[model samples]
Target: MMSRPLATALRDATLLGAALLDVFVHVTSDEPLRMAVALAAASLLLLRRRLPLLTFLLTLPSVLLSDAIFASLAALYTLATITRRRTLLAVCAMAYTLSDMTRWTPSPHLDLWNPSALITLGYTAATAAAPVFLGQLVQARRDLSLRLTEISQARDHERRLSAQAVLAEERAQLAREMHDVVSHQVSLIAVRAGALQVATQDAEAKQAAATIRRLSVQTLNELRHMVNVLRGSHNRPTELTPQPSLTDLRRLIDTSGIDTELTTDLPGDLPPTLQRAVYRTIQEALTNVRKHAPGATADVRACFEGDTVRVTISNTAPTRPALPLPSAHYGLIALHQRAALLGGTVTCGPTPDGGYRLRLELPVKQEP
Candidate 1:
């Protein structure tokens, strides 16, 4: 590719050569003064872009003295392309027209209204207007190209912002799930191990329980740190875990140690978002049961009802008072957020039988 300065220099050389050829064809070398003025006008074309107005003024004398007006036309066009001053361009065009219309050695007693003279004046005006209009057209085209480039850059910037916002939202969601689900289960393990360490009589069994409790506590600490990092207010990049779906419900219940009964009749081809919402709803409900209702049994029922799939988790009253523990209490809020995103609803309240119930309902086909 040719560099800009090199290309510009080459173009100036070409225009100067064309102007010199015009001078050679019209202005005779036998006339020393006319030839010198024409050559000087052509040489001034090299400086047209840098000093357009001065170059045009200098070339006008050559147009009046001889027929070599190529340099003057080129200078006028260069001026028109670079400046937005319309009045100045019109004045320059008129100057060129008047200069081209008159001869240096005027005949005494020349008619002011000759038909041939009027025709010559009209032709000179039209020729001068040609370069002005063409230069304006080139100027408008360059402006339009620059405007289009700016618009394209703005759209690309907006797209990047939208993508970052989506990624940040997903990271916050993952952080919520880890806090509600993983933290809840680890706390349970720590609680159980603490009880076993106190209740067991064998030295080896007590030591094992103590080890488990200590490790569980450490794991919970690391998990809390990870959650904080994931929910970074600044929205930095982070790793994501696999999402839970309805198929994992059975294993979740078994490992939860909450004495829960699971009954699900969901379609196998359910959308991933719908499946995830169902699974998280049940998990959060069970976690709540384990936290607030000790030694209580839960019943999890999920099935299709018309166009909606309904999941209900009901737990009996606690057999013993629940031990106080540290909690952020964001489980139900996160569940509600997840349901809202899927165009669903989550409702929970105390039951008439002194127990708690959480219900989730979602449509099989979501709306846009």
Candidate 2:
């Protein structure tokens, strides 16, 4: 593509060449004074962009002295396109018309009432007005193009806002469904478990009912958090419930139902993220035993080895026939991802004795 400066330079050179040609055709070399003025007018065309009014005034001498008027016309057009003062443009047009019509002689006379003189005056005025009108037309075109670009940008912005509005509405609907249907069902389950715990006479049955009530309440709390998140409550800070950590491990094992043992030498002051990762890994391991290895016993071990924390969970093979259950099967994958985030590693596989063993190792001090 041609660069703007190069294009503009080429255009100015072309206009100057045309002005030179006009001077060559009308102003003869024998009339040295008139020829000099015409040449000066043509050369002054170079300053039209920056000094249009001055260039036009200098070129007027050529229009009055000789028939070379191209430089004057180009200057007037440049001034008209750049300036919005219509009165100034009209005055300049009138000046050019008078200069073009009057002869170079000091005592030049015009018979104002003569039909030919009036017609000549009108023709000169129309010629001067042509450049002004063309320049204004070009200016209007530029303004219109700019206005159209602004309008297009505004429409695109409106479309984006409308799309966001639709997405927000969908999220609100999902939140309402979870609160109205899912929460209500979980609330009923918790109430029934509480009632069962109170009414049951068998100690084992009462303990089971208590565990069920506790788990249902926890699930409800989690559901409420999810609904709030979905509802897009950004006006105020939302306080999420406390996340699980090493401190909650004992309660989790007690409520897990499967026979499990937990042994840990992890410090109480460990970073909350590390504690949560360890807690979740043990929890998932025990849950898998209860679901896929019914009647299996699980052993969870966690200890600080120098600058690293090592954790392992092992479960014996199922004593009874494993029941088919719905699973997303992402538990092991999730554990590995969690460990990786903490600059750690997780490994799990079946043992020779028909058992499963999962191990996680994490650095005690996290890298920034």
- Number of the top-ranking candidate, with lDDT as the measure: 2
Taken over the whole model, the C-alpha lDDT of each candidate is 0.90, 0.91
lDDT of 2: 0.91
Q: What is the lDDT of residue 277 in candidate 2?
A: 93
Q: If scored against the real structure, what TM-score would every candidate get?
A: 0.60, 0.60
Give a tens-digit lDDT track for model 1, residues 1-368: 99999999899899999999999999997989999999999999989988999999999999989999999999999999998999999999999988887757756233549998888878988999999999999999999999999999999999998988887788789889999999999999999999999999999899879877987997798898888877884455555456788778998897666888999899877898899899888988988898999889999999998889899999999999999978999999999998888888999999998999999989888457
Mind giving the per-residue lDDT tens digits that candidate 2 earns over 1-368?
99999999999999999999999999888999999999999999899989888988888999988998998999999999888999999999999988988867879877779999899999999999999999999999989998999999999999987887887788789889999999999999999999999999999999999989999999999999988887765334566768888889999988899889999989998889899999999988888888889989999999998889999999998999888998999998999999999999999999999999999999988558
User: After superposition on all CA atoms, what RMSD does each candidate show versus the true structure?
Assistant: 13.7, 6.7
Please list the residue runs of candidate 2 whose C-alpha ends up more than 4 Å from where it truly belongs after superposition: 1-6, 28-55, 192-219, 229-368
* TM-score computed on alpha carbons, candidate 1: 0.60
Flag clash pairs in model 2. Answer: none
Return the lDDT, model 2, position 149.
94
Checking candidate 1 for backbone clashes, the offending pairs are none
